[model samples]
Target: MSRTPHTKTPETAPAGGKAPDPARRSDRSRRAILDAALALVGEVGYNKLTIEAIAARAGVGKQTIYRWWPSKAAVLLDASLALAGDAPTADGRTGLPDTGDLAADLKQVLRATVDEFNDPAYDAPLRALTAAGATDPELAARFTERLLAPQLALYEDRLRSARAVGQLAEGADLRLMTEMLLGPLTYRWLLRTAPLSHAFADALVDAVVATA
Candidate 1:
């Protein structure tokens, strides 16, 4: 499928007569490329996605895509991150919800994640990415650094807050705590060992928090 991107006018010179920002000049095309990559992955599956197809769908030349991303995996990685958006937030803040009741907040977020994992639109594309990452060490490293680390940091931040309030042990390893809370859910989602549900999410939160 082809999409006609919205045309953007050139940026005006600054008050000091500086040239228009080079990065800003390409923002429109960048957005179009990312959006196209995301949509095509959802429709065609990541294995079938290609730079040529993405360039065509985004209305840009193939060389333009290669100029920014080395491979289709990199393009898909950026597209997935774009779709995930900024850190998980309820009030537009980066940290996870801290409602004093750490268990409840964790459950809420985990349940939402369960919902996302169960979504048809997200399920296939995510599975495709996971399969690719399993075999490609380079892509896997990029995925962990660019996508997984930020999410883990958010959870660690919340865990730190809980520890400060005496809810979590002062000596608790925040990084381990975050991983413990999320690891099972991720495993289940990726392996499809069982159905992902709010009940399972709540149980996982209770189990991890009890240990912490």
Candidate 2:
């Protein structure tokens, strides 16, 4: 099916009749911008981050950054969303896996999440987003709506499924359960205290599952 990209992709004509394949310049620039933003946040943190600095680091025009995003918070939010887009679940969606054993599925998810929490790529941008969220309520709302809520919904779905199949107790508060699963990892990440490893993830899973 013939379709159009939302943004202009580079289309070059090599003195020929047919247009060359789309170059995906918009996508590249967007990625570069995001990379630059995340790196800057890591180096100097969110408050000191600036559009010009991001453009300079990305090797794109300042106007390019402005054309795509309004503020640093918006850029961070989009970057997080973009990363989430690439991370598909076992079902090819952004969510946890279901292996009949809720504990196992949750452990697998948390293990991977622990790795990401330690990885600089995710750690920096996530920390920046949280910092931005603290200072800017509007950005926080958008971040929650765009990233947090959807992810929470996935856990909710999984918990609901568990309940239906008698894996979860009757009238268990899925939302609180979701928080219990996520809270520790996020807290450890923010604290920068210990290594976020599979071991820690396993412990969290065991702790939460013990209560269940």
Candidate 3:
């Protein structure tokens, strides 16, 4: 079957978990590799995805992948980062979208997030990543460090701004507040407890602001 423009073959890291510098790779090839990795992992799960399969799908040499990443987990990590709009800075800070109105800024950010979670492109790969993280401690830690924590820090930055402007309750635990803002939505997504929708986003915003 011919691959769609969106479909690309996955890539795996080298035997020892070494990877190449992404900056040196062609942007098109890198995107192809990441796309392939995500699609393969989503379709076959991580264990069944091989470097050969990914290389074939990506139209790249296995050595190219081996030169860059040390393991399949590393490729998935990089792919997930690409899918999520790049990793936050090394300081664990990716500043939130700022529009002066805290509520609007947050609502806008969350809405975009809801859209990402709802996207099929994002959903399958994310699910695969979550599944792998469940059984692999090292992969899980890297996943948290590379993907989850930085995203959470974006929320932290927004909340801190709200606190600074007195939009939040004085002395509010920003960490807990950030959890309150995100935990329920994640709960719904992970557990299928309910539908995630714009209505849910509005409700979440209301609940969060009411407590602020």
Q: What TM-scores do the predictions have? A: 0.79, 0.83, 0.82
Clashing pairs in 2: none
| Runs off by more than 4 Å, candidate 1 | 1-28, 42-47, 86-93
Q: Candidate 2 — which residues are off by over 4 angstroms?
A: 1-23, 87-91
Score each candidate by Cα lDDT.
0.81, 0.80, 0.77
lDDT of 2 by residue, 127-180 (tens): 877887888898789989988999889989998988999987888889988899
Error in Å for residue 129 of model 3: 0.6
Superposing every Cα of model 3 onto the true structure, what RMSD results? 10.1
lDDT of 3 by residue, 66-98 (tens): 878887888888998877774222222348766
On TM-score, the candidate that comes out on top is 2
Better of 1 and 2 by lDDT: 1
- TM-score of model number 2: 0.83
User: Which portions of model 3 show Cα errors greater than 4 Å?
Assistant: 1-25, 86-94
Worst 10 residues of 1 by lDDT: 8-17
Any idea how many clashes model 3 has?
13
Better of 1 and 3 by TM-score: 3
Scored by lDDT, model 1 comes in at 0.81
